[model samples]
Target: MSTEYKGPLSVETRKIAKDELREDDNSRAQALRQMRDWIEKNPKIISCRTDDSFLLRFLRFKKFSVPMAQEAMERYILLRQTVKIAFHNLDHTLPKMAHLIDNGYLFAVPGRDKLGRRWIIGRPGVFDPYKFINEDMCRVHGIVYETLMEDEENQVRGFVHYADGAGVSLPYLTLFTPKEAVRIVKNGERTLPMRHKEVHVINVPSSLKYVLDWGMTLISDKIKKRVKIYTTAEEAANNLDVSMLPKEYGGTIPMSEMIESFKKELVASRQQLMDNDNMEVRLELFSVQAKEGAVSALKSGNQSCNPYKTDVLTGSFRKLEVD
Candidate 1:
């Protein structure tokens, strides 16, 4: 297996990929070739990375399903094109981004959990919303997720997000309008090709929890089921492994060291993030398709669910099913 593939796949993870993800050398090669051919044939995809490692991220996320991989790739391209705020100027060396990193706005822990899934700790309260908008938060989140996805182990093992809402303020909650909130949730579930195993939010105040409850209504049931909330750090630690977390969270690792290590990772990935700015889609095609779809929906008298509408908050929030 080592001779056949040169990428970073450990023996244990390779077995899991084979047994669960249905990834074999032949299947991997075939999927890569098909994805590359699709990219070459698609005129709208102005530029993209077709390397085996890059392509494998999408293939593994879709469990080697070529069609699903194609769809995910398309959504990914469209996301980059439409979400300009998140994808623009993705440079880690930038002062605002650096500040966020130094303060550990969002970062992956040094080690994996017992289940082999990586834990990404997020502290949204660390950044002042006035200085850095929600878009900035999304941009930093994108950089961290993108960098982590490069690892084959993370692709197969998946990720668990642990958010500490201790210092979150009402102003922070105000940063996300209904549209922005819905878009962010939709992007994480559909557009981004990553295995989101679970989300654990601890130390959430009443105000933060209120907003989180509304935000939860926007995600798919699969994701909603995976979301868990706790009122205190001790309660959260009872469910999670303490040794893998920082001292603040009843873990051995220091938060300072974790932040420093993640900063180095961001620095290492700076070039890749800069190059990613070239990935784009021809929006005119999507614009025309959207208009046609609207006309068709009107003709058929079908009212589509628009979660972004202000009125969506007044009643039961509709659940978006995962594909």
Candidate 2:
């Protein structure tokens, strides 16, 4: 369930979306007040600023369940602390990130899909492991964060992703391991607020399928059900609106134009990304220490997670379900 509002939503649409998420301006304001008060009263368990917007983002993601949202917020803080490569020191000025943006390696295309979900496309081939370290995963998070911010105020239904692994060369394949793939996918699925409508993977060579399948094992069955693999771009195009895709994928828009447009978005959002990177999530605020090895793992850029230990919310109100 997503709305196609590109800008300030109509009052009716906003109300519906908020109700669907079990929040309204007044309800959200009250919840934020209560959460902030709780945080101040019990500063040890969690540390959060009174950033209403930040709190509300998570609240919306959790359907305004104060307890659930609080837990999610805390988990997000720990995730950031634990996954340094994808969360630490992100800035738009990074040369590698800039190159990725310019080369169409990672980008969200302008406009929505036929169903109104946003379209985010990534080309792993555009990444040069020699120049771009695996730690650049943090930069990918930064880009995704900016994309979320872009549509935060609007009523968004969900997201649809297109991942092209056709460019996976033998050397590139060697550097890209299943472990790192699991790390990236886990961070995204567990932490991000967006509902992924589906993921269509195009140009999947036999060599890359094993890594892709292994990574899928790490994600929830719900997400796994939404993933579709096509041996060629043409077959994938049949399942999506070609008019909304770029020419490279048999769409109307040219690849050069898409890249240039995406570059502008990156430039426009650069400062915001830099600010978010430095924003504090004080995991040590709790009397107990941060995760035992999180600090060291983060420092050495060796982020990993026990896929089975992830938090799974259970209830009738859970908006996104596996089936």
> What's the TM-score of each model vs. the native?
0.87, 0.77
Best of the candidates, lDDT: 1
Instruction: Give a tens-digit lDDT track for model 1, residues 1-323.
Output: 12134678888898999998999888987788888889989877888887777788899988999999988887787777677677767777778888898887888898788889888999977988668877788888888888888778999999999998877766665566555565677678777878999998987888556567667766778899999998888999999878778788999878989888877877788788778888877777676543222222123333243423354542222332212
Per-residue lDDT tens digits of candidate 2, residues 50-144?
56556666777777889887876676666666666666666655777776776777777777765556677888888876676667745675675
Q: How high a TM-score does candidate 1 get?
A: 0.87
In model 1, state the lDDT of residue 272.
82
In order, what lDDT does every prediction score? 0.77, 0.64
For residue 70, what is the lDDT in candidate 2? 80
Model 2 has an lDDT value of: 0.64
